[model samples]
Target: MTEPSTMLAIDPAAPGGPEVLVPVERPVPTPEPGEVLVRVRAAGVNRPDVLQRMGLYPMPPNAPTIMGLEIAGEIVAVGQGVARPEVGDKVCALLAGGGYAQYAAVPAGQCLPIPQGLSFVEAASLPETYFTVWSNLFERAFATEGDTVLVHGGTSGIGVTAILLAKAFGLRVIVTCGSDEKCAAARALGADVAINYNAGDFAELAREANGGRGVDVVLDMVGGDYVPKNIALLADEGRHVSIAFQRGPRADLDLSQVMRKRLILSGSMLRPRTVAYKSALADSLVRDVWPLFAQGKLRAIIDSTFPLADAAEAHRRMEAGEHVGKIVLEVP
Candidate 1:
């Protein structure tokens, strides 16, 4: 089969609002050694994409200027060293960049076979959020069954995945969302308690939900002022894993509480990690979490989808923060 010469891609002509994400035709990229060329079917929209569009999250050196981090597609061509994902295999990949196009050159190790019974749209939503949650919440924080976890942004892609996975693994989950509707959505997704952050203090509610001992783990995406509140919400020797700082990056915290409580504060950024590290994470996810999908214990929550040409509108919806779960862009 012959590959196309050009494909449509979303490019942020100038760093600004969603309207800047303009569609343009560009030459299809070739796979490098250890990579594969994917015929993209769907690409997941993430907060990082919004940050990238604002010029705050610059593309890593040597990555494509296009803005997408995860995609579900068919492998059309394989690079020399890649042998496992043969041509025609459908896969969802954790891409460092370039998933916004109709064709993407992705490292083979970052690709996972789409789980049984999952559509391309569902698979597309998996990589970025799952990888981040697994790497940080499970691996780094050492979260386990019988423990209590407090998740912020409960209706978000990452928060929802964390809630489902934590519940499936027998952990009690508490979440905070901005509205009552989102709070209800989080509860329906198996969160033990959902607090409307706008209505009340999440730290106090989380503690009450955990029987006054505070939670065993906290998955925080809202940083800044949330840092102090998150620290206050943790149990003795509890872990705080931050994946984003949508509120702001700077924080003023009291160290006395951290010391007395034996709290562990840590965070990670997924895009800049080495291929070997990400590949290992992919392997771990397949072995541990993929089976949960087959059993219906885990599922993707899609809020909306748009054609590739209307990616600008998709970004606008995401920026509004009114939608729950994941938003995706369909290649066709």
Candidate 2:
């Protein structure tokens, strides 16, 4: 391996806008116990990364933190006691933080072999969204075959992935998107019903489509005004899992509605979870979902890729709500 004193990365000194993100050279990290030093081939751009950059989601009391949550790379060096993945293994990891760099240290257990027939760019897009969906929607929400699921952001990377995976598991999917074209895109991606949230009431549409039974589950990212509507749209014993709040988090809840429906309200953030816990989520994905991906039955939805130096542009696109799938940064 070539020795380099520093790595090129996107850094945010003060968070306000996309312009705040600037390229910088930072010291390369070394792997600690149970970790592997990865030569990053690509890193995924996610909403959380943007939030972290703006100081909304601070970096665990650590300043000057590198921004990223998932990466695809080759294991260039392994720390002591790590045996399964040796040097030169191509993998993707669910990072706690610090994925936007030429090299980043990741826990060995959080790494998974890249799915067969996937490029580094595609692999980089899977870890964060897939892990969050599996853990929250399937595991926590008890979403099962024959159930009906309402995904709030149909054109999004998470929404598309949820629709596909839910369909793969024999579940019915309804998604909400901003435009008719985007709605059509969601339908083409396996959404049973694509409602234009700008023009239609998704709660009513989803309910009508389900024959007034209401959806069995809702995977929500828009949290403000949608909260009550979410409660109204759920079937008895239904589950609502929120992974983000694009509309803001403060909302009034009606306890009576929650009681009447017997719904489960839950939220999960993948980054703050323990390595061991996240490793288990990764294991389940490898065991259950990897086969489908390998068979070409399920794959990632990539919206765009930008050079690492153009991260600010990537964040701008994301904030504009113009992107439909995952945005990525090419390391080389």
Query: Quick one: best TM-score, which candidate?
Result: 1
Give the top-scoring candidate (lDDT). 1
| Candidate 1: residue 160 lDDT (0-100) | 91
Please report how far candidate 2 places residue 50 from its true position, in Å.
1.3
Can you tell me which runs of candidate 2 are displaced by over 4 Å?
61-64
Clashing pairs counted in every model: 0, 0
Residue lDDT tens for model 1, 1-332? 89889999987678998888888998999999999999999999999999999999977789888889999999999999899899999999999899998999999999999999999999999999999998988899999889898889999889899898898899998999999999999999999999999887889877877778888898889999999999988889999988899889989988998999999999999999999999999999999999999899999999999999999999999989998899999997
List the candidates' TM-scores in order.
Answer: 0.99, 0.97
Q: After superposition, how far is residue 123 of candidate 1 from its true place, in Å?
A: 0.6
Candidate 1 Cα errors over 4 Å, as ranges? none
Pairs in clash, predicted candidate 2: none
lDDT of each: 0.92, 0.87
Instruction: Please give the lDDT score for candidate 2.
Output: 0.87
